[model samples]
Target: MTARCSMRLEERSARHIDFTGREDRPVQIHLRDIKRTPGPPNPAGLDHDMSPPPRLQQVPTSPLLSAFSAHRSETLSAGRALFVEGDSGSDIHLLESGLIALSHIQPNGKRMIASFVVGNGVFSLSHDGMRLLTAEALQECRLRRVHRVELSHLPADQAEAVKAALDREPWDIQAETLMHLHKDADEGISYFLVRLAGRLNGPISRGSRVRLDMSRVDIADHLGLTVETVCRGLKRLRSDRVIDAAGPHNVIILEPDQLKRRAGLGPDFD
Candidate 1:
């Protein structure tokens, strides 16, 4: 005979967890949630196209430049170095007019141009740190140099806008650098032309043209190609009837679609 013991189970009422402590935690802010003042409406009466092509969208107008315009402005002649690599990055530069080239020096002392900073572009955003790349004026330029402390003193909204722009700058440089690195000389040249056309806001018509102010040497440096290779590539594009040269600095896109294909941008072209 075995004596069995009976066990009884009792259910307890569920208790609500306290989330009051979580309410005291800091709320994270997102870049997209920061609203920016709308820019002036287009005078051309064209409806604003929010979704631009990748190449065109790569360099958007920086709110930092606008906010800092009155701080300090200086003009530099063509071929002048704005800042050399390894220099103290106490200040950031905003290109108001003309072009600036950002380059890196190799161990052998050869300079490799990495990217071009066009008007309304910001560069050297290291902010009181050592500069990562050398900046030079590709053409006569007017730039506004703002000290890191000044940027820090900006209003919260404007400061956030500047931060967003600064965050995007490196990714733009990498995308352009990789674009040139992976393509053949001809394709690279075509890509450069297409990019310039887009930047210049040239018409998208078949017969539309764009003026490339940079010389062949500049193009070579920017595209990571030899000057001779750039010349040959240009000649090939001309022969293919994809483009025609109005002068040494001007290029007409005779066949926009064909040029886009050669640039590896695909059939959608724009």
Candidate 2:
């Protein structure tokens, strides 16, 4: 990715000024070749569209699942996009299992992950029948798509559940947005981990283990921080004994109260 910088000079050179206010001199730009970090090997034959039309495997069904699966059920292999931004959004999606990411492509072609939909989460309730973000599978996923009209036909209990899920989405997004408001990187990262742990690992206790489904890159994009900042923040958290990194994809909450303190949150924040 090309990095950009802004410059200001009072010399009125009427020419491009470099970072140090040097004018009328060729600004030397250095290109660095950085190797992409290797992640898990891609699943074979799963790229460039899930051929033969992905279908869901049989699983025990529930009232909510049955209602949502009325029209269609599908699966997406890891790394496959379920839908891109600007796609028609007449149907709502219920993620039965695995992880999905909702993101937007900026004008500069950078992707900003808006949120992640964990298992049993409901998403894509678009107000204008238009998708504002793209949805992609972070893991092999099972999902159901139901037409908007079908929501009214669901049983009262199921309808209420759906309503509650939708209701929580805004608050969740708001909390994430608030995380970005903090100027301190560690504070923002701590708050993000706490919110994510609540969603992925249930109630936050000292021993709660959160499976980090999203990568550091994803976290950086979602939190509006550089990857280096995220790395440093996590290092500080570990050093302070607030959390422990079990692996590349697992984190254990060591001192929940301390973590909340670091995040500038109350004990009852979660």
lDDT of each: 0.64, 0.67
Residues 1-270 of candidate 2: C-alpha lDDT, one tens digit per residue: 443221111111123222122344432211111112323433221233334544775553666665664445466666655666665665667887888877776777566778889987888736577766667666778777767776788888767766676677767766777667764787788888898888876769998998887666667777888766787788778777888877667888999988988888899877
Stretches of candidate 1 exceeding 4 Å from the true structure = 1-62, 125-128, 202-204
Q: Which window of ten consecutive residues has the lowest lDDT sum in model 1?
A: 27-36
Q: Candidate 1 residues 214-249, lDDT tens each?
A: 656567777877756777788888877888878656
| Most TM-score-accurate candidate | 2
State every prediction's TM-score relative to the real structure. 0.71, 0.72
Candidate 1 has which clashing residue pairs, if any? none
Q: What would you estimate as the lDDT of candidate 1?
A: 0.64
